[model samples]
Structures are given as structure tokens and as C-alpha cells.
Target: MAVDNATVVYFSEQVVILISCGLSFLGSLLIICTYILWPDLRSTPRKLLVFLSVSDFLSASSYAYGVWMVFKSDSVDCVVQGAISTFANTCSFFWTVAIAIYLYIFLVKSNRRLADSWVLYFHVVSWGIPLGITIAAVALGRIGYDASEVSVGWCWVRIQATDHVLWILLTGKIWEFLAYLILPILYILIKKHIHRAHAALSEYRPILARNPQSQSPSSMADLKLTFIPIIFISLRIWSTIRFLLMLVNSPVRQNPVLVTLHGIGNTFQGAANCIMFVLFTQPIRSRLMTLLCFCCHPSRDTAGDGHAPSQRGQGAETPFLAEDTP
Candidate 1:
């Protein structure tokens, strides 16, 4: 009777999470489609837009696993959903940190060329390092079984939270949360300062207002990107709250409802960053529209199937004048 009741509750929560994941996924796809199809959107905001779209896609993928296994319950096969859940969560955090670091280097570094090199390094480390760590974690978990098995719906390794293992995992968790949540807050403060400085400079030379789209921290589209980390932070908060309550009394270390919610929430965090970039950023939207028109309505759309930079340079050069004589 107790097992039966647990199953029923699991069934119901899974359904809710599935629906939520679907909605978030569809929304993310539409937004990405918009950004990719437009050229004006991609030129200046290209790198950042790419980051958001990738984040959203990963989020959607993570959510899809939950809907497939959790809500449907024992009816479906359970793969490494726990591992995936762990990977996606860690990845989403890292991506946000990448964006923040990118913004920081761009705003602070006087030499654009050196900062550009650092940006490439950031991308490699951001993308490459997390997977290595996760593999180590999962291997560690499997070498010595933490618990009976990996959790029912989760894709990653589910180890028994030994005092030592928990401490190590918690250390990583602290860094993840700080890098995503705390560093972004710092970025905002720094951005606010830079914006003020830019505003002051504009007073002296009006032409400074017509700066490169890439230089500005908050573009017309970037406001959306800026708001998304805040949502991810909220997800962490909800997870933390439920976790604290569950921690004190429970030995099993599992709650179907909370687990379902956290999985869905984390996925949404990944997808939201990308979708928000597409929907909220003007450059992405415009570029995507143009790209779409070129593909679907080639006659109507004049943007040829060429590279992103050349087109962007042409579009951008109009705003600034040629070099002056010494």
C-alpha cells in the first residue's frame, strides 16, 4: 500500500513536470529559430546569442528525459537520467559564468586584442572542464556504490551521501552557485558602473554613443540575457529550501515531488537563457528573421548565404567615419 501510494504521487508529479518541460522546450526552439534566421541579429550579438541558444537547447534536452521516465514511472525504461541531470545542471551554471567572465574582460581590458584571446580560452575551459569533472564524479560514485542504485528518473550517478563524498560534492556545488549567481551580481554592478562611465563620455563626444554593438554590456537584446541568471538563481533557492527541510529528518535522501521540480527547473534554466536571447535581443531576432526569409522566402529576403562577419562589417561601418590625417 505504501509503495503503491508513492508510485501514484510520482506518476502525478511526473506528468506536471513533463508538461512544463514541453512548454519550455517549444518556447526555446521558437526563440532560437528567430535568432538564427536573422542576420542583423547575429553579426554583433553572434557569440552571445550562440551561448544562449546552446544553453536553452541543453535545458530542453534535460527536461525531455524527466518527462519520459519520471511521470510515466515504471512503465518506461530508466537510463542515466541522474547523470544527465547532474551534467546539465553543472553545464548551465558554467555557461552563465562564461558569459559573466566575457562581459568582465570586455569591459575592463584596455587591449581588445588580448581580451579577445582570453575570450577564446574562456570558451574552451568553460566547455571542456565540466565534463571531465562530471566523469570523475560519476566514476567515483560507481566505484563504491553510494546507495542501492541511481535514482529512478535521474540520469547521473546517485551515490549515498557519505560525509566525505557529500563534503566534496558540496564544495563543487558552492563553486557552481557562486560562479553563476554571485559572479553575475558582480557583473551587473560593474556593468552599471561602465554604463555610467559611457554616459559621461557620451557627454564629451556624442560619437561615443555610436559604439560597436559588441562593446555594450546591455544590448537591446542583452537585457533578456541579463535577466535569465536571476531565474536560475531562483531555481537554486527553491532546491536549497526543499533540501534543508528534507535533510533534517530523512535518511532516504529522496523526494519525488522535489526531485521532479528540480529537474524541470534546471532544464528550464538552460533553455530560458537561449530563448530569452532570441526573444529579447533585437540583433538576434532581426538576423534570424532575415536568415529564415533567405531560406524559406529567398525571393523576399536579400541576405545572401555568405559569412556573418562580412555582412556585419558592412552594416556596422556606416555608423563610424574613416580614419583622419595626423
Candidate 2:
């Protein structure tokens, strides 16, 4: 029994997608639960991260829906999958941008907290924009958005019409290009600002050390915090590059190994965020552990009460989210 390469690749892609969906679903769910149960994680400064987590949660769920649709294929299901996945994925991208902007303003530009009203602006831009784009694109697809084709495995933006460039531009390439441009610039600026701040703190370490209560927060911690966006952009860029390569060289898509790797990187996008938030963040991990212990011992009277830092430079109170710019 000689299985064709196409058959092997198709099966491998499905398996990889299923694994990615499971990892993303559980990982995002744990993050959501950790945030919901821990009141300390719900401060105003952390609202962006909370919003981002919600977006990732939806994205993961959408991926699962896409997988289900593969089993029960229909024209309506294809359209619905495209609409839902596009909207959710777009929100995730915008949320990441919002976080980057928030970090830049709070960490590099000024010490002041973002006004509470700013959250309204973030939600409007992040959610509202995606809603509009998804509606327009899906509506147009119904009327023959040529590049908006659905695969049996999943529904995503793919070029079906080599002659009609408009659909390809609107589908995903433009947004991906914007991401490629914005993320690198932000990353460089953030790293530079952090390094400069660390040097300034070192110069005054002796003075700060004399007052144990007022010691400067660890720059290394801040550096580690910046790695979240770095890793995110890196993973996304890798997937995007492979996608572009596949578009140009369709034969490469038949390679099961490359296809599997691409599925693992792209489909598990939410899982990456979960690992960063739960594993890399000390405050969240501590809170999560306490919650688990309480669940295990229902009679334990000690419900761990703690405060997370609302802003940078708060001694001994590191952020449970992404605020690491002391």
C-alpha cells in the first residue's frame, strides 16, 4: 500500500491542527480562569492584557470550530468559519499592537498611567475595526470575493484568482505587512529604552540600596517582560513567511514536514501567550498556585490576599500582567 504524498501531507496537517487546537484551548482557558478568579489581576493598568487574553480565548475557540467544520463540511460552514476566524484573528493582532503601544507610552515615554478613558478607545479600535473588516470581507465573499477560498481542512485567506489582486490585498496580506513593519520598530525602541533606563538605575544603585524599602526594581525582569512581544512577532513572522512561500511555490505545500511545522506555529498562537503569562510571570504563577491549593483543600481558610503593582517602580509588587518597566 503506497500512500501518496498529498494524502500523507493532508493527514499530517489535520493531526497537527488538532494538537494545536487542544493546546491553545486549554492554555487560553487556564489564563482566563486565572484572571477571573484572581481579583488582583484586574487592575486598570492590566486591562489591555485582560482584553488581549479574551481575544486569544476567542481565537482558540474559533480554531476548534474550524476543526469541527472540517469533519462536517458545508458551504455555509465554510463561510461561517472564515468570518469567525478572520474576526478573532484580527482582534488578536490589534490587541498585541495595543499592548505594545501601552508599554511604550508607560515605560519609555512617561511614568503616568493610561487614563481609564483610554480603555474605551482601545476597545473601540481593537474590536470595532475587526468587526467591520470581517463583515465587509465575508459579505463580499458571498458575492464572489475571488481570493476568499475555503479549503476542506480549514478556511483562511487564500488567493484563488491570480488576476484579481483586490481580494488578496483585503484578505490578509496587507494586515500581515503592517504587522511586519510595526513590530520590529517597536521592539528596537523598547529594548533601547530599557537598556538606557537600566544604566541610569545602576548609576544610583548605591543611594537606592541604602533605603531597602525603595530599591529599584530589577531591569532584568523588565527585559524578560519585553520578550513576550518579541516571541509573538517572531512566531507570527515565521508563519507568514512560510505562507508567502507556499503561495509562490505551491509544490512546497505538499511537504508534510513543513506543513506540520507551519500548523504547529500558527495554530498554537494563543498557547504561546498563555505560556508567557502563566509561566514567565511570577505574580500570576503565585496566584494560580494559591488558587489550585485552595481548590485541593476546600476547608483551607487562607485565601491568599495580595496586591499586584498598578504601575512601574512599586517596590516588591511586580505586575501579574505585562507591566514590567520600573
Residue 44 of model 1, lDDT score: 25
RMSD of each: 7.3, 5.7
Off by over 4 Å in 2: 1-9, 71-74, 111-117, 142-152, 158-165, 199-220, 223-226, 303-326
For candidate 2, write residues 55-169 as lDDT tens digits. Answer: 7677666666665545232366666766776777778777777776665665567543553446678899889988887787766553121121222245554334343245544
The TM-score leader among the candidates is: 2
Locate the minimum summed-lDDT window of 10 residues in model 1. Answer: 317-326
- Judge candidate 2 at residue 156 and give its lDDT: 59
lDDT of 1: 0.48
lDDT tens digits, residue span 184-280, model 1: 6755764565566754533213233444653555553234335646666765554554345434535333566566555456455534554454444
TM-score of each: 0.66, 0.77
Model 2: pairs clashing at backbone N, Cα or C within 3 Å: none
Q: Per-model C-alpha lDDT, please?
A: 0.48, 0.58
